[model samples]
Target chain A: MKQDQDEFYVGYQPKAPAGIAGAVRGTVVLLLLLGAVAAFLIVREQKDIAAALFEFGVVREFEGVIAAKPYPMLRVARPDAAGDAEAFSRYLLVAPFKFGADPIVAPFDGKKVSLKGTLIYRDNKTMIELAAEDALREIGGGVGDKPVSFGEVTLKGEIVDSKCFLGVMNPGELKTHKACAVRCISGGIPPVLVVRDGEGTVKTFLLVDRNQGQVNQAVLPMVAEPVAVTGELVRLDDWWMLKADPESYKLL
Target chain B: MSLAYQAVGWNRQKKVYDGWLAVGILLYLAVFMVLGAVLFPSITAETLLIRGFGTASFVLLHVILYIGPAARLFPRLLPLLYNRRHMGVSMFVLGLAHGVLALIQYHVGGDQFPLVSLLTSNGDYASVVNFPFQLLGFLALGILFLMAATSHDFWLANLTAPVWKALHMLVYVAYALLVAHVALGYLQNHAAPVTTALLGLGVLGLFGLHAAAALREGATDKEAEADNGWVYVARVDEILENRARMICAAGERIAVFKYEGKVSAVSNVCQHQNGPLGEGKIVDGCITCPWHGYQYRPKDGASPPPFTEKIPTFRAKVTEGKIYVDPKPLPPGTEVEPALIQGEGVA
Candidate 1:
């Protein structure tokens, strides 16, 4: 057939028709430009990566009493403590990846212990990642304080894995991180019900059963989802504890 | 045409096509990665890589799907359709990387097996918006892998053209799954309205292009009127020399070619990949398929010696200054004598 005015492109030909080459070049340029624009849109739309920090590779030594009830944590006494003042600053503790520090700190519960671990923090919350080899060294037995009970209340918020929300992962409490949160919670990481109190400031409450026991296994399906809980809110020094059964948490 | 497969027969056009493809992929990836790192400082390396490769592959898929309809709408864009398998394979590789990285980050080192965790972590399948988007992506990746694995001509030949074509058409299913993945998975959260709008526009645009191409093809595909056994093609001069005028008569698709004072007819469907031969040009004395440059003799509908491809030919004649072709097709590789166009000289 006679060649039309429009250049016919043959894949095996040594040279493309000039008109076809020009068209393809123009299309390629436009595609690249569109790609950059798409990238910009997607990157800009990303949830502002939280200002949380994870000391990924830095380990520091700390001394504190291991609080192994409800969740594993380190209760370091405040340096400027006086009579009738808040006594200890609590830091939630977890092992590497998706596990809570229960197995590591169970033996030293209520005992003053020292360990080398990394710190993860966001807002006012802190969590320590313990080293596997001799993670805890019990220095002495320490007195543990009972949680000061506040009245029962209802709160609405999302359930998030504490390790990731505090800092292991950025922007960690949403559908994007849902599976990770579920995996973490299922693997025994402490789950926190992230909620907003009357003052409108968002706070996280360490979630536990009605008897104040670990609820990691029971709260698996509810992680990273909007939920409402009616529970007794208590304060253990700086730590906020929510006493509620996992089966009672309502999906919202 | 190749006598035996040798991985790929490197042609200058293919090299140029692949070289530009690589450049486009790298440029997009670089922009996404470098810019994402700069903009989202707290994003992890694994997340960055996963999003980078995922977005790049997603973009490549759009372009790849765009080319088929674009080539039909504007023939000059056929060059893009030629090396499309390369694009498919590259997109699959990128998707695989994204899936593997995500699995390691979210599933590995957890309490359960990674794959089981991925499948069982979220039980909200009953909800449309909250359906596990990763599951959609996983299924799409599986489809893409199938298409990519069988992209070679060897597989095409072994599976036969009709089956291979049907198999590759699963790309639409894969594309739909990916769109759902982005919509219900990524956009289910705090996505900007503009991002959602753009996604909607992209889906609409893909459908629009396909509709437009189908509309353009409607005219040629319409059934033609026949007198006795032969059907009217086009006026002798209307079919430019060395070009074929496609005519759909009854159920058969015919291409009537006029060249050098002679007229010949052959099936419009090329033996290779069912490419539209009527849209092709006579190159080096053979009808060269625009899609892959597969050539067949105009008279006998057979590939030149050393290539075994053949297509059905049809009896044709130029009578009263108009070309007509028999609605019935001759056997594949059947040689039909060209009917002389009385007034035309050698073109």
Candidate 2:
């Protein structure tokens, strides 16, 4: 085919490289199977029980006093509680009624109310979603706001989403989960401070603003890593709430 | 060779190119995933995949971009330029996987659509700290999809060479978008100075190589002098042994070689991907293409036996220690005796 022809070449053409048909075929099949397995596992793994909780159709009754800070929450006092320092008066109840008027406010504040809802509890964080507007019924007794004391403390921990850290994502707090954690926090998920005391007992605190509003954008950088937070700690309704400025957290 | 298509045209070179490409991708993924798992034990699988594929694609894009200018400076690097489009497509796949996984992980399960959420979630565009970086990534991915879908000879044929070349050049835009994406997206959260510094260094290196090559070519273009029907390329002593000096004349680039006490000239453009043959050396008595090792005889511009590739040859003479080559090119593979140096001893 050797010819002394004067053909004007116009452009560059790619040459076909060596073949790997069998290897390529095998790789495609393997990747397909792997993708299937990965999807199944990712979908199957329980990140949150929000959908399952709604699916249960279970009606729960809670007769408790409501605390109207951060959000309107119920403090269901445990009756057979001993005088132990670790045992708090009541556990705070979270309600999933965002972007609307709170069921318990002003007139219903500090009042004994019996609420009916589907209860979702994971780790130490508990939230309830009402099925109907009339689910929260005011029972007649009224009590004044409990006197709260805020003590300054320094704690080491990672800031994480209350939902995912409680049950949704297993081992969710790390450097690798930084971006996702930031997203979750930015998407209005309440940030929780997960810490270990000197005894190595893991404790969680709902991080709030100075006036106890839900902490969002400010705490994004502190999520998913070990950091030392200096803040005012208030033990209210069986939960420790941390109120601190974003600048107070030091990365460790 | 028609405009009608086959999914892939498998040849010895293409098969090898694709095989190595597949193997490279697999190895990269395996290493990335394994290292991620070991280094970050507390991270979820979703996070690992996002970081893994994201870094892999970013690194691969840089490698793909470097091949062009690197080949220009050194001919031996031409092999990397061959079938580089495959590398490009592979990068897009990895990038797509990363983008999709990240979207699902961070944006899905919300009230809004995932893609919509990605675009709208971070609305603090005015704030540098909270800039909408996901938009950059999405735009980049869009450009990549366009390039990948049209990276075929069929498109080239229909679109015409100049149009196709110009359209494919959007890769630079995609590259710029990806740089901004990483700078704003990943680095914003994970502030590792080493990683950031490395990325900066890579960008600088790319610009540095291109600028250096362009400056060299600019000097060559300015130095070339033409007379009547021939152009002064270089002095006989200017071209190193077995090497060639390239010159542009009469709307064609030519490579004038000095070998074995004789001088010869041929088209500078390689038959395989138009690699600069002047950058290559005469290996085993043939002008070996630096890009993919395609060889041709210096005297006839023809490939050796069992190969039929050819390129145009030109008349070159060394008169008074200065080499001058005719602007007119001879028919490809036409044997022409090399012009001998006057009074010079044979090597």
Candidate 3:
């Protein structure tokens, strides 16, 4: 049935006039076409999803030296390293669900421990989300640390929550992921300043105040916004650490 | 159209309408998710669900808004308007899904409560481009929920037509908030041309359709004054058989229907949804409403036996080849004699 101006439609009637029923059928075809077009355009327009991987629900055991400076991290020496590069690979450690691994790993600071956790990695960056309980148990080895200084410099980038950016959330930087970044950072996850070089090479630095303490709360207002910070760039093993007060950061 | 509503009155036509509606929604979601995964192989499942549901609800809102004006311009499209409230409720449910899942994925399991974190997580309230866009979406969802909760005819009857109408008018407010939500939330980061173009087109199309409908309605809204206790209607010949010509007189819209060689006048507002009664033709000896087909006898403005709805009727007469209506209304259900067109006087 078509929508003839002459045919009156009473919805309570068991049947629609043939013309209206036919017109509604035509409308359905039209709507389906519109839906297809919308779906294609919308999906095709998405920003690229990053090639990050989060090995969610697959638990693996690991052994490494714990470090609490700047943020909680595990330093595992690599036997495959060539000649004078950093001897160990630093795996950022975070507790499950929007929290830092500091409290869980702090008791074993500077001591080697074994733990079960999930791995979240992107490019060269890696992080571990520790099991809810019994995440770290000391395996009995002491650690000595030497920090190499890269000198004071000014760099520009967006601040992001390290756990999410490492792999937990794809493209987890800037305004789109700002709220989650803020939540993660506020809950004590390390804040990272992510700088991308002109050629698209990316460098991430664990942000800390001048005292080398956690700056998660201090950097909340700057998370996911492009900003510039001047600080001493130092290296603790394979991890880059930015030593600066949150007050020195400027919105770009 | 309903004597007593029971959740919903199931009719064959209504079942067909809902079945098609479900098909449309499922088709949209399937396309979005399947195509999204094929295109962005690394896209997370949660992100896909969020985007698919969010965009579907937003697009459906544009369709819902378009129906009212489109039906006015093309009355044959009235079937689309018959079950519009169902569409509203479905749109709200989709929106709720998008909102709740996005919140859980982002804000929950954090140190603060999810709602608290949602409000306090962003401090850029003063900046337009940097405003908390999620907050806009949250507020819009709240309004959508309110509307869906009160959508039943039971609420319409309890709240009174005017108040229910006024509450639902907040759809424009909700629409504005959603526009900002998209502009500030997604477009601020993505800025894809197709996304922006679609949003702009929906806004512009709605504006164009409504403006055109309003202009057409303005022509018929011209008021006629009374002379010697009667208001002049159109010529008797102007109203075709079993059809009506509407006139605004005596502070009300009166439909002067000519049927069976005689003329009668009644209030133009239908008892159901206040549909334009004048646009409907006489069906089975009763004046039918164009929207829901609620019927009333032209002589007394009363529904047939077993239907209690009624409207005010006016005394009509034909004189010197012209039709005239008394500028005062008889009580609802009061019977009035039909005017003889050839004899030029009320029978």
By summed lDDT, which 10 consecutive residues of candidate 3 chain B come out lowest?
A: B38-47
Top candidate on lDDT is 3
How much lDDT does each candidate structure score? 0.86, 0.67, 0.88
RMSD of 3: 2.1
B144 Cα displacement, candidate 3 (Å): 1.0
Cα TM-score per model: 0.95, 0.61, 0.96
The DockQ values of the predictions, listed in order, are 0.72, 0.09, 0.72
TM-score of chain B of each: 0.97, 0.74, 0.95
- Spell out the clash pairs found in candidate 3: A1-A18, A1-A19, A1-A20, A1-A22, A2-A19, A2-A20
Write candidate 3's Cα lDDT for A74-146 as tens digits: 9998888988877799999999988877778878989989989999988788999998878888998867688
In CAPRI terms, where does candidate 2 land? incorrect
- Name the regions of candidate 3 deviating beyond 4 angstroms: A1-5, A83-85
The better candidate by lDDT, 1 or 2, is 1
Per-residue alpha-carbon lDDT of candidate 1 for residues A148-195, written as tens digits (9 for 90 to 100): 899898989989999988888877788978999999998888899988
Give i-RMS (Å) per prediction: 1.4, 10.8, 1.3
lDDT, candidate 2, B1-347, per-residue tens = 22247877656666666786786667666765665555444445765687668777877787788878876775334555656888889999999999999788766754456676676655357876556778888899999999899887678657765677788889999999889887876566553565677679879989998998898787655545568767888888887877888888877888888898898999987764466787767877988766545688999999887776789999877778888888789999978788787743211
Error of 2 at A109 (Å): 14
Q: Write the per-residue lDDT of candidate 1 for residues B253-334, one digit (tens) a residue.
A: 8888878789888999987699999998888899989898899999899999888999999988777898888888889999
